[model samples]
Target: MTESPASKPVPAREIISWAFYDFANSGYTTVVLTTIYSAYFVGVVAAELDSGEPGSATLLWTLAIAAANFIVLISGPIVGAIADFRASKKAFLFASSVACVAATALLSTVGPENVAFAVLLLTISSVAFTSGENLIAAFLPEIASNKNMGRISGYGWSLGYFGGLLTLGCCLAYINYATGRGLDATHYVPVCLLITAIVFAVTATPTFVWLRERATPQKLPPRKGYISAGFGHVLTTLSHARQLPDLFRFLLCIVLFQAGVATVVVTAAIFAQDVMQFDSQQLIILIMVVNLTAAVGAFLFGFAQDRFGSVNSLVAALLIWILAIAVALQASSEADIWITGNMIGLAMGATQAGGRALIGQLTPVSHNGEIFGLWGLANRTAAILGPISYGVINRLSGGDHQLSLISTLVFFVVGLLVLLTVKEQRGHAAAARAN
Candidate 1:
């Protein structure tokens, strides 16, 4: 069932359904990872245990996120190989999606007294979210034409931002209601987490129902066990790095720059809270603007990547990230913070869409899950390194966020310099030959 370049045309219905999964999962990413619950984890949920110690809550939260990413990094390629061999991407997607939704909903029960429970649920949900992302992204090559891969990836991302906007809107509505009722707004966090889970469940229905499995199950290679085959393929791919230099090189760059990008995302609310003294509502508003601008960026840059090529498009976006963090480090006013956030949104949207599309372009549709597993490895590696580094820096600096912001600039610069070695067409050809 692995597709050549001439695979049958993908239905538009299926494509839209596939994109809706992005719309669904993004609520968790924005609401939990970047905005509301992240702040709650630090300022409220973990507040009791840490006894108001500097950086303790942030460190705990970072370690939980780091642990989740570490799990994904180790396991993604193996699961990806099995899914590819079995042509059971939908099955993997369903399991991970349910785990994520359940964990997200269960987060509602965690309060100040049970920081351990909150961290546990966060770790589970983060792993499920990332696992689902790897599988869903594997489908890109199945659905898109080479010419429109960037645009289609952008479509998914732009739509994802709108989902974030809608989820934030829901939180805003509830916060307003709570305030009018003379209630503490922060206590309403568990309820908002519940709302996020429901949104994801409702929106993701179309993906499970409409998206077709394009890759048929293949026989196990002679004498190979599932786990062995999985690890073997990954090792073989690595050994042949010279043959797939662009893909390998792209992964190297991803591990570096994505570390910087994810650090900014996970720390943005904290930075705003600590430096700008933003309340929950203000932080939510700021994230909403970032989501709005991110949608615009995805729409604009989706095609820009197609026209200019993924490597070039990604390089430009990384420059923006470098500039954004530099500005954030220097900013002293609310206006300056706003400017930095918007810049981050633009760069994040473009780089993510371009990076996914670039992988689609380089990989064969047949071995997609395995290759995208590599993508997952890079992504989660960044997830682990970025948050841990930021957490450590915050601890060392006694929560001095400006110093942490300044440190991320180096990741971007190094990643950009390394990215110059890739040759896109060669990677595409090599992947095709391997499949």
Candidate 2:
């Protein structure tokens, strides 16, 4: 028996499930990485140690983040390959989700006396969350039609921001109601993380149930040889990408631009607390404002992409980021920081959703997971550099945050230059042939 085609497109329930994972996972980004947990690490965990120590608690946090990025860089391609071969995207998602939940829940045990244990748990959770994101992201093109890909991607991002906003709000409420007069706000960080993990696990169930994996064209290799096969495929894909000038240019632009994006995200909370001296309430407000603006930006840019093309929309977003970061460097007051945060919110959603949609438009279907795995590698590897550069510059310049921010312009400028050389029409043609 053959399946019947419906007049109206089947509602993308599976796609929504895939997207909600972003929603579920974003709580971690907002509550743990960006605002609450970071503050806890620097303020509470690091406070126990001596000031101005070279290998102090702050250094350990930075090293842990770098380590997680490196692990993702190495493992992304192999995981993508395994998912593609086994048609096991959902399975991988489930496993990673569980890992994230377990690690995050464990974070609640971290305290002033157990700083090392806290960082260790956070590192594991961070790695798991990121790895899970890779699997969920790879499922996008399978569920979204080309015409609606940008819009769907926008919705996913919007939902993620909303999720972040919700979690941030809850944290703020908890702080207001529960904390005593003299208690450090940092003590509540682990509780927020634990809540985030529970929410992630609960919300992630629909995705596994609703999403169906598409069959992969590539044959499954023997279990003993799969690792070698995956690596071999990675090398082959890299060679092919080198030969395709447009693809090569796209990847280069992605690396540079995403580095800038990562820098903004990783540093936003730190910048607020350390440089602007924002309190927890103010930091939560700032995060919500940015997240709200990003939701708006994603919708606007997705519409613009449908009309003007992804490349044009992306270039426009990059220009906005350049201006935002420039303003961020000069921002001193809370008002100025809030304005900068809004601008970042505007650019963040567009840059990421548009870039991913562009890749979906450009890549050959047969190589979707492989190509996206490479894209993930570039993103993760770039993450390593962005934070390290920010930390080094911030530490070196007598803790001058502005100088560290100025470094981001290099990424945006270089990314724009490389993007101009790419041929979108050729990429579309390649995609058509693969289909």
Best by TM-score: 1
The sequence of per-residue lDDT tens digits that candidate 1 reaches over residues 1-435 is 666434578778999999999999999999999999888888888876457568888888889999999999999998898898899989999999999999999999887888788889999999999999999999889889779999999999999999988888998889878878887745688789988999999999999999988888888999999899989878865686777788888998999999998888788898898788999889999999999989988888999988988888888898898898888889999999999999999998998888899988887666789889999999999888888888988878887878877668888999899888888888878877876
CA lDDT scores, all candidates in order: 0.88, 0.76
Stretches off by above 4 angstroms in model 2 are 1-10, 48-50, 54-59, 180-183, 216-218, 221-224
Name the lDDT value of residue 82 in candidate 2. Answer: 63
Q: What is the C-alpha lDDT profile of model 2 across 1-435, one tens digit per residue?
A: 101112235456766777787788888888877887776777677665537643244445666777787898999888777666666667877888898889988887878788778778878888898888777777667766567777877878888888787777877777776576554565566667777877778777777788776744467556746678778778877877644557667878988988888777766777788788988878888888899999899878888887788888888998888888888878867788877888889999898788887776776666667777777888887778777777677666756667878778788888988888888778777666655
CA displacement after TM-score superposition, residue 348 of candidate 2 (Å) = 0.3
lDDT of 2 at 127: 85
Error of 2 at 216 (Å): 4.2
Clashes of each: 0, 0
What is residue 121's positional error in candidate 1, in angstroms?
A: 0.7
RMSD of model 2 against the true structure: 2.8
- Lowest summed-lDDT stretch of 10 residues in model 2? 1-10
